[model samples]
Target chain A: MDIPRHWRLRKQRYGLVGEVCESCNAKVFPPRDICPECGKEAKTLYTFSGHGEVYSYTTVFDAPAGFDETAPYTVAMIKLDEGPLVTAQLTDLENRKVEIGMPVEMVTRKLRNATDERGLLVYGYKFRPVMN
Target chain B: MTEKIELLKPQRPVGIVGYGAYVPRYRLPAKEISRIWTEGQGGLPVTEKSVPGPDEDVATMSIEAARNALKRAGIHAHQLRAVWVGSESHPYAVKPTSTIVAEAIGAVPNTQAADWEFACKAGTEAMVAAMGMVGSKMADYTLAIGMDTAQGRPGDPLEYTAAAGGAAFIIGPAENSVAEIEASYSFVTDTPDFFRRAYQKYPEHGHRFTGEPAYFKHITAAGETMLKATGTTPEDYAYAVFHQPNAKFPQNVASALGFTREQIKTGLLVPMIGNTYSGAAIIGLTAILDVAKPGDKILMVSYGSGAGSDAMVLKVTELIDERRDKAITTIAYVERRTEIDYAEYVRMRGKLTMK
Candidate 1:
């Protein structure tokens, strides 16, 4: 990933910041300016509570480039408490099985190592089993 | 006339308004480490050590802890005037971990950010600076974090104990504090006990030299100084915590300082979580605060290689009980763990590079 591109998405990547539509009262993730519900401009920033449950999940044995080191990792579609489904990698699994409705919480983590040894480290949010 | 070196106190009394600790969920048991290297024949230093997942690092863990601190402090991130991270294993060599933390917590733009290093005591160094900032009223609140994903040579003695985890404390005025800082003392000297040159993958210690002349000397001096200057004895403190590189070091040090096992038990977590380096002492303090009652006096001491110690006396306030449950407790992080084998540990720690 390029530095500027990653930098641009920092708010979303770091804090789960997204848009909330006033017209339809919908929460939009990935922060699209236009609301999917009302087709209106939904630019008000809202930080997710980072609490969610696994809507669906898959364990990736064959990892993508820049992620081979962490192969056999699980990626899940999380249904946020606020009614948005976001795709993220589930971490801190500790060998436990991931169920469809397991509760999880957001945590900041290294998304991947730098593009190269001299490149920048990419960090983002991942979900883990909630402690409580 | 003789010069006097007195314990340092904030002008207006500053204390930990909120505090949080993070221990990675993964555990690499000592026997697992021994199984690989020592054929499971050696006496282990600790029962287990916390291991950062492939994705976790100092910056990420620090952010988690800081968020917890913010949540417990009941304040907006923007209200923070500074964010200082103390660590030896900052993911980036040149970039500042403090900025990443500040930005993640939404404290950027208006926050003074920097990183501090003093070996293991790096966290308390930041804590001392935070005291100064909040004490002088230069900042209403400041965040100081001590976190690390410390590494050791593949088969070195340090490997068994070098671990991942840390704690964050929000320093503010006494009125809002959960624990009021009464006084602090620092003892430092030029000593070459441990070093990891720039770009080095693992740190090298001076074998037994790390003890006696380094950890013991500095910690004892700072501990005794803080006690004498405050006109308090070890018996006065309800609890005491020390920088724990392993279970033995803190136990030994506590005994030497006149603190009994009962006084040190609540804060001695290294046996279960390994040595979190910069996070060692502060995380222990967090654990102590987890169950401490109002009016409970606590003593804390942290030692860093190359070499120094920071000691402080804190008195738990009425706010402790009300605020402590606001965030995850240290014991919860400790219990919410899973055991990993040596092979998984190597994979998570990135000890084996993929071509």
Candidate 2:
């Protein structure tokens, strides 16, 4: 499987960028087309520090049928200092310590690919611990 | 010295000019229902309740009630001033069911709207809030609705009573009203009789704890407080509407408070439609509004199992004759209903699902 276009784009940038509205000063992780607060069509470019803390998380035991090979994975909502919540997965702390308020940073990792050696490609964002 | 009334009434008079109700087109018998449910029996509360078809959700059920209400009122959706839907089991937690129903039923120009939730009493509570808005002159006419396709952990006694249905009322002042808001009151208590966690779909409840603290105590407290506020006795009411969770409980509470059978036909909906959660009390109110004559007095009680109760008194106006066909008559709400087995019930309740 080949990587999806979005995955390629994410791979191209080691760091993901977000946007903050000039009118309301509200930060958007996914980079909204317009400001949710002021409805302004204008947005200012900003790179995340890639640092955040876990607000809530859950480990998925029941995945889609073919994804069984990837037995367990963590999905979480992270609160960034920039002031927006982003939905991502926790990594690096896989076999170690991970808590509600654990500090994390963004990392480009291979999520379960829908296709194996001779298959179709699917990928998403995951997170790992920050190096102090 | 007289008490000052701070709440001023709205300008345009609102009334339910149109109404429609849909029960899933299937029926189940008591014996068939009993074979699966361990709790059901023959003697006291004998009738089996109606169930929803697979395609119906809280959204669809509420639309059916709204259609009937709008039809009876003989008014277009453009006439509405605001819309409110009461439900604990909303389709999407963040997205409002009021918008969906409003758009579908034609309340438009981006009207003042929201979804209200407080448990089984949610629908009537929506009714009360809409009354406040119209009474406060915020809106000329408003839609107050209650609906639920509630879930129960399979095999629990609440499973039988947990059912699908909805009721909608348009609130305005009394000039041409079918039912005028005479007085409304509510009593609240911090009783934790039943609750469902956010992560959990089915609810966990203290079976008997719901009876005393949540059901009897709160409802009775509100009932008496309302009666006292109105300075009347049970006999003064031509009808009494209670949040009916089952065939027996509401009656037990009513009889304990001196209400006779003649005073509560609306309360009998549970024996047929099951426990509609937010829809229970409002569904009963719809029925009472159907048959009420001019000058008839009615009392309504709403309870949410966390828990709390709101009691209200309504006076039938001469306009009762104008929109007599607007409500989901008891027969139509029951007759059109479809029935499902324990397994299907489990599927709808989401106790069992296909991956």
lDDT of 1 by residue, B151-180 (tens): 888889999999999999999999999999
Summing lDDT over every window of 10 consecutive residues in candidate 2 chain A, give the lowest-scoring window. A114-123
Model 1 chain B poorest ten-residue lDDT run: B346-355
lDDT score, candidate 2, position B317: 82
Query: Which is the leading candidate under DockQ?
Result: 1
iRMS per model, in Å, is 2.0, 22.9
Per-model lDDT: 0.92, 0.69
Which regions in candidate 1 have their CA more than 4 angstroms from the true location? A113-116
- Regions more than 4 Å wrong, model 2: A1-132, B1-22, B27-34, B37-46, B326-328, B347-351
* Highest lDDT against the true fold, candidate: 1
How do all models score by TM-score? Answer: 0.97, 0.68
Per prediction, fnat is 0.67, 0.00
lDDT of 2 by residue, B268-349 (tens): 6777767778888877877777777889988888889888887877788887787766444645656654456666555434
Residue B274, model 1: lDDT of 96
